[model samples]
Target: MKLLIVGGTQFLGRAIVTAAVAAGHEVTLFNRGQTGTGLFPDLEKLKGDRSTGDYAALQGRVFDAVIDVCAYYPRAVRELLAAVETKHFTLISTISVYASNEQLGQDESAELHTLTDPNTEEITGETYGGLKVLCEQAAIEMLPGNVLIVRSGLIMGANDHTQRFPYWTQRIARGGRVIVPPALDDAIQMIDARDEAEWVIAKV
Candidate 1:
């Protein structure tokens, strides 16, 4: 199978690419070529920015599955489908889409955050989840039954550039007592990028 990955250079995106390639699938990456440029030296890299409507590189290209790992806005999702032709569309969504996180064992059917202003494209911490929700909707609207969305939680693993989770692990290695959250039980939920990548590849 031929897989086209959007933003296949950082964190979870990089993991998906590696997993897909290891699974004997032909992988093609589409990104702005800004970060993680040194990685995946042997694969095909299509330089473009979906955020700014720069999908010219993806024109006429078709794939078995299009794994979008970095769509922040619904507008970008719309632009993406218009640019690439693919049989299946997979979106790497976040758990942040939930309207409330206090509930335990919530599934994808849980209420999702809503975007206050639909026309605004500005992405900030407050709008991130809402924008992602919109992104999911956009894909579903375009592909109907051909879209799959993975509501991923905090992704942490090797090649994670954020380093927020790694900071705690590194501190623990230094032989120092670390402060943990007051709600210890089920206070945290995270998925490793590599593990998620493997699952995504299998599904694709």
Candidate 2:
């Protein structure tokens, strides 16, 4: 299978690319050529800015599957769909789209956040979940049954830029007065980047 990956040079995206290549699938990366420019010297890379909605590098391109790991807003999703032709689209979404935190064992059918102003593009802590929800909705609307929305929780592994989980691990290793957050009973859903990548490849 041929794959076009958006934001394919960082963290989870890089992991997905690695898995795809290891599985003997043809892969192409489309990004602004900023991060990990020299990481994948052999794979095809396209230069363009998604924020500006510029996909000139992807003109007249088609793929078996398009994996969008960087899409965050509805307009960007639409712009991507308009730029490419593909049989399948996989959107990397977040579990934060759930509307209720009080519910335990929440499944895919759980309520998701929705934007009051559909035109809003600013992504803040207040709007991130709703923006992801909008992006998922847009992908579903565009691809219908061909869209795969993977709502992941905490993703941790090598090449993690956020350092969210690594900070705690390093702090614990330092053997100092590491301040641990309260709420030991709170549910934590963590998935390794490699594991997530494998799952996505299988689904795709």
Candidate 3:
């Protein structure tokens, strides 16, 4: 299968690309070419800027599946879907879309966080999840049954730029009194980058 991956330079995207390659599928990465440009030298790279809506480079190109990893707003996703409506679209959504303080083992059917204004430009950390919920809804509307929404939890592995879990991992590696946040053992679940990659590949 030929796959088009948006934002395939960073941690999770890189892992998905690697997994797709390992699975013997043709993979093309679409990004601004600012991060991990030196990593996948042999792979096909389609450069574009999502913030400024510069997707002219992707015109007339189609793929078996398009995995969107960097879209944060409804308009961003809407533009991409309008450009590539023929492909099976897989969106990388966050588990944070679920309402805060979720029940154990929530699935895709779980209630999502509320969004007052989906197109608002002032999206802060408090509104990230709600905005994502809006984005997911737009994706579903655009792609319908052809859309696969992979709700992911904390993603961690090499090449992680966020430094969220890696910080904790490094702290734990030191083997000292780690000042962890409250509810350290409260049923935390994380998806390894490789696992997420494999899952996406299989689904696609």
lDDT of 2: 0.92
Model 1 has a clash total of 0
RMSD over all Cα atoms, model 3: 1.8
lDDT by residue for model 1 (1-204), tens = 989999988889989999999999999999999998999999999999776799999999999889999988898999999999999999999888999978888987899999779777888988888999999999999999999899998888898889978888888898867787777675566889999999999888
**Ordered list by TM-score, greatest first:** 2, 1, 3
Instruction: Return the top candidate by lDDT.
Output: 2
lDDT of each prediction vs. the true structure?
0.90, 0.92, 0.84
**Model 3 misplaced regions, further than 4 Å:** 172-176, 182-185
> What is the total number of backbone clashes in candidate 3?
0
What are the TM-scores, per candidate, against the unseen true structure? 0.94, 0.96, 0.91
Q: For each candidate, how many residue pairs have backbone atoms clashing (under 3 Å)?
A: 0, 0, 0
lDDT by residue (tens digit), candidate 2, 104-177: 88998898887788789898887899999999999999999999999998899989999998998898998968
| Model 2 lDDT, residue 56, Cα | 94
- CA RMSD of each candidate after superposition: 1.5, 1.1, 1.8
For model 1, the superposed segments whose C-alpha errors exceed 4 Å read 184-186
lDDT of candidate 3 over 34-90, digit per residue (tens): 998797788889888878888888888878889998778788888887776456898
Model 3 global lDDT (CA atoms, 0 to 1): 0.84
